[model samples]
Target: MTFKNAFMITLTAGSILASHLTQAGSPVHITVKNLSDQEMYYQSTSAMTQAHASPTPELLIKGKGSDEFRVTNPALPDVTTASLRYTIGNKTCEFRTSYIRTIAPGGLFSGKLNTAPKWDKKAISSGNATCTVTVTSTNFSDHSWSVVFTMK
Candidate 1:
């Protein structure tokens, strides 16, 4: 092959690789911690509608323990929020938060929390709940990310 042809082929290959890298998104690692004395249930059904990325299965977080899951290839500019529900006795309390935006590919992009989670006054609930949400860039090369939610 001519030198010119070889150079053109190398340039084309490099361009394709770069294009793929640019389109690549980071997988988000999600963790939910139940800091209260009672078990908590994380429902993704409602949040899934607004979520750009979310865990596939619903989670049950034990009291004073945590559960973890992952979301693959979250798109950039992710505006995902979390909704947590807890049942103590006959009363069930639910808390929803504002969107936590993550624009960067990778490091801590944004962290948000509602220390005093709003409870539905109309619902007959009995409990005090707090929620925290954090989004961080874990790896840059592969664009790995982490999203942590803590409930107390």
Candidate 2:
């Protein structure tokens, strides 16, 4: 969530929630913080940018089969159900694959990635890709919430 703007850098965080319930009001509570060398102030982005980070429902697809992963309904509000894929090396293997159906504000969904995916370890040292969560349209949302995480 890092944005480059001269001497200042900004990081913004929001959540994505997908379920079969009703979306009453707003979905995400967003905040912007400025990390800069100079004493800079916080200025919000246009509604267009906010719309990008806002959470929406989509497919929990995975594996080479790309199946629809299921979860209990009526999931908590202000949360995200993310299907994360972490690769080991340049080859990009599917390490850990699951849905984090809840991401409360100021909280991190932490877990150990699959160091050894269902691949041949002896023959292959590592094969992996970036951690990307692609949102799919559900009965709730006509659109999808898609975001890409930059590998560090």
Candidate 3:
């Protein structure tokens, strides 16, 4: 090869090696939003807040589908029912839930959490009920994602 061509090839090879030796690019990030209603319920039923107790702040992810949701939460205490209460206009609405997350720390359980939500304007007003969601976590860890939901 000609001297110029040879020099160009050598330069190209050196640059390629240098480029490969370097690391680059931005990192992937996961953002968690507290899309949770920034409200609180002092007196309630059918649902509880994530800050109620230890193993609390149980994250509830609401979504839509026939596929059952499965999560592990040991803090859930035994309860006949649990729910999430909200007020759409003057009407009181609730989402009844049931869960089968493993009770023992690290243990995994599976079941349906009250898959259906309930909305009763009278239930909320007559019962003097506040907006809330009920749940039972035998383990009671603050990291339980007890319920999952999707925004409309």
- Judging by lDDT against the true structure, name the best candidate: 1
For model 2, how does the per-residue alpha-carbon lDDT over 1-152 read when each residue is reduced to its tens digit?
A: 33465224322212223322444222222111112222222122233222333342122212321222222213333333322232322433221112223323432445533221110101111333233332232223311132222221
Give RMSD (Å) of candidate 3 vs. truth: 18.8
On a 0 to 100 scale, what is the lDDT of residue 42 in model 2? 16
Off by over 4 Å in 2: 1-64, 71-75, 86-90, 93-133, 138-152
Worst 10 residues of 2 by lDDT: 116-125
Q: Give the per-residue Cα lDDT of candidate 1 at 51.
A: 55
Give the alpha-carbon lDDT of every model.
Answer: 0.51, 0.25, 0.32
Q: Per-residue lDDT tens digits of candidate 1, residues 1-152?
A: 99999999999999987766555233456666677887677554465422533545345667788776654433332333434555544445554433333333333444633122111111123555455566543454444556666666
Clashes of each: 2, 9, 39
Return the number of clashes found in candidate 1: 2
Best first by TM-score, ranked: 1, 3, 2
lDDT by residue for model 3 over 1-152, one digit each (tens)?
Answer: 99999999999999987665442211111111222343322233433322233333323322221112232222332222233344323334444444332334332455434322221111223233343332322223322234332112
Poorest lDDT segment (10 consecutive residues) of candidate 3:
24-33
lDDT value for candidate 3? 0.32
Q: Which of the numbered candidates is closest to the native, going by highest TM-score?
A: 1
Candidate 3: TM-score? Answer: 0.23
TM-score (C-alpha, index-matched) for candidate 1: 0.45
